[model samples]
Target: MTQTFIPAVFYRGGSSKGLFFHARHCPPDHAVLERMLLSALGSPDPYGRQLDGMGGGTSSLSKAVIIGPPTHPDADVDYTFAQVAVDRPVVDWGANCGNLSSAVGPFAVDEGLVCAADGEALVRIHQVNTKKIIHARFPVRNGKAVTTGNATVDGVAGTGAPIALDFLDPGGTVTSGLLPTGQVIETIEIDGRAFDMSLVDASNPVAFVAANDVGLAGSEHPDTIETDRAVMALLDRLRRAAAVRMGLGQTPDSVGLANPKIAVVSAPATFVTLDGRTVEGAAQDIAIRMLSMERAHRAVTLTGAMCLAVACRIEGSLPHRLCSGHADMQAIRVAHPSGIVEAGATVFQRGNGWHVESGRVYRTARRLMQGEVAIAPFEGEGDR
Candidate 1:
């Protein structure tokens, strides 16, 4: 079989990594695009390891991004994110990957898609999936984005330049409004039991449940959480039910694997990190454990952190009730299995309802590789 090459760049943005492509180099038809991405990432591998492709066998590592000229008037470029399932032939575009969003600006600047002078460069990004504008501010030198600095993200090792992401009006990203179900708190019954959760849609829709309600301390490592089959099954059911409530799907069985992520939250507690470091309870405002692609995430997703931050500010949400003392603080420190990540949200109550002015987080991104990714030629294409 002959192979075809597509120009792409591999980037590690925050804690997640993915392949980035220029829009001009990709086929316009989404069917063909999905096929190419699946092949390049080696999906549908029953063994759960994408050994034949670029994927690193996890949700955080199985991703693809496309960059193009802006379609929105307020943006400098267009950014689309795709989450490729490692063990299934599925590509979910229903939600945005906040971790990888940090790389879009640097990718644009380095590729000459956007011009920036030396100093703090600002790139207005049109997040296609969420229909939101993310203002990315980072340092630039010699006409390129600087990649070295003192900033460090929790999941990633070492320090790199910081990328400040301000999600403007990051409410109702994938739903009708911030409080998707028109309520700050709701109860969903699964397996003949009622579970109380907050379904908020800031940046990304998430169903936040108290850790004790799920029989957890919320400080467990990813491996420990993943090994608990009953908890995992319950979380999936809750996520699907929340998706239906948020109008992302008609029924629980029809919900996609990406959107409306389910998170378990608790008041801050002392715990040990994956790297064997100790995290004091008082150091963080709240603790969280999130699942992605049906696996316990080692660290909380950036968007999840932002959404939790926003949830903490809401009057009666579960997160707010758990961390009521820090509800009015500008920044909310979240404790995940990895450590602590700080996120901030500006929210206010209006006559209509609660309004989120913006959600902000800082991340680091670096271009790991720049070249072409080889894939088998399409079935109908002739050999070159």
Candidate 2:
């Protein structure tokens, strides 16, 4: 009954925390790795609670990131993200983890994959899953990474140092074009009605729709939203339909890729945040809430926030309708379920069309533990 252990780091980056491992340390075989991850996270329970594993049994906690040497010339590290299902004992490699991305640079710097000076330095990371490059800017003092600053992100409780993240050419991260459909907005017929939607494939591909059309105020709590099984069912249908239209899948049920998230937006309105703080509509450009792995995110994902920023900057888009005319090509503030998150974008018009040059945001990361996870040797054997 001897168990084998794998080296891992349990760290909190932004609003989420997960187990992270260097890519080289993981097995190249799929079945073996999947089994190993299940034992590490403890899953396949019908109760939806992962009481026996490292997983907290939530979408945010059941995540893993694998970082290794980059395959691209300009990139410094290769990041592979996985979302392990708490109840399935299976890892879904179909999407990127935006929260964990904030830690890739620090991990690379700590692991000696990339070198930095005694001040602020830029670490280029190639998101291997999407083949996109992200410039992660972190502060360094005396040759070590510094994690102290005044910048505050809403989802996280305490204010710390800032990590400036610039996602270059998010439009082509997954494919070519900000609007994969080559249009800012399109009308889709679903359930015998026409819904205005925007399908964009930036850092993440997302289908943006109006909240009012979906019978929502865009200010509901995560628990309240998830409990409405009817709403969840409708969203699932919409997501599946959007997935097929975006060419990400052949059918609604096959829309499993976590990137190109699906979201609904609405004009800013007063709502009590997760922390119980009142968010004033006048102080925000737009109010939005997004779904992650088919559930409302407690706050918002960094990549999703990037997509929202891009949507806002573009004219004739749902996000643009919520703007107060203050957002420009450089910066825009979005109001999420947690509070407010500010994202930056580089854009310009070319040949009668608008293009997203890049998108940027700030996130924080910290290593919680460094150790190995043990598992039964029989697990993951010959698994496909």
Candidate 3:
């Protein structure tokens, strides 16, 4: 009844960590793959702590990455990310994680799945969920991977080499256009109150609203935000309303799969980050606090940054109010609880519609460890 152990790499890509699996080791069938991954990560536990499995009992720790040679024509590698819940043994594969995408290129090169020359290699990764292309620029010296550099991320400590990520065609990844609601901004009546909302799908779909209306200053730390039961109640109501309006679904208690993320925005204010570094509020466009999977994220989500960038580039909206007046390119210095992270997007006026060629973001990742991971024994007969 012993399950075969497979070699994998445990990496901390940006603020998130996950186990990267070689594509060949994963099941090809969708249902079988889901079952195997659930067992492998040790999910569905009522206690919420993945003590008996590899999951680290949080969204940041509970993750998985699958990569290999391209199955489609225009891609170099197929990258898939899974978010495992802490309390439940479920993997939400409906969206893409740009933070974890940083680890994939190096993992592929180390596994000999792809070849890199003596210098930098361009990794074209096709996200399976959104089918969007994430272009990663990696440094390779002497046929080995380089994890050290001069690039520094807000949440992570120290400085390392830079990995420039270009998110192309961020619009319409899941839906049909950049503005999922067919408008740049709209007023939504939530709980008998009118709130200005921007529904955009740059890399993922998000509904941006003002923080003050939600009774938040938008500068509080994650712990402070998490403890407020009233804040969570308002967020839940907004999220449910936004989900239904965005064509996601009409389930009040269970819109888990269709995530209509709720984001609160405010004028920037100086604060000490969790890492003890001080960030100036004047240097940022707007302060943002995005809720992920119905919880306050330790740091701002990567795709959340993309949505912010896209918002800043537009002409009229909550984010557009903070734009620097430059019509060509806009850079948003988003302040998260951990620290400040920046994402940039170039805007061009093409007659009536705006064109966002790509979104640029910087993140740091390190290979923490590499070895074989042994899963619990499976006694049932093989489906295949």
TM-score for all predictions?
0.98, 0.94, 0.92
lDDT at 209, model 2: 85
Per-residue lDDT of 358-380 in model 1, one digit per residue for the tens? 99999999999999998877678
The lDDT for every candidate, in the order shown, is 0.93, 0.79, 0.78
Error of 3 at 329 (Å): 5.5
Order candidates by TM-score, high to low: 1, 2, 3
Q: How does model 2 fare in lDDT?
A: 0.79
* Candidate 2: residue 107 lDDT (0-100): 80
Best candidate (score: lDDT): 1
Cα-based lDDT at residue 263, candidate 1? 95
Cα error, candidate 1, residue 236 (Å):
0.6
Indicate which candidate wins on TM-score.
1
Q: Residue-pair clashes per candidate, as listed?
A: 0, 3, 8
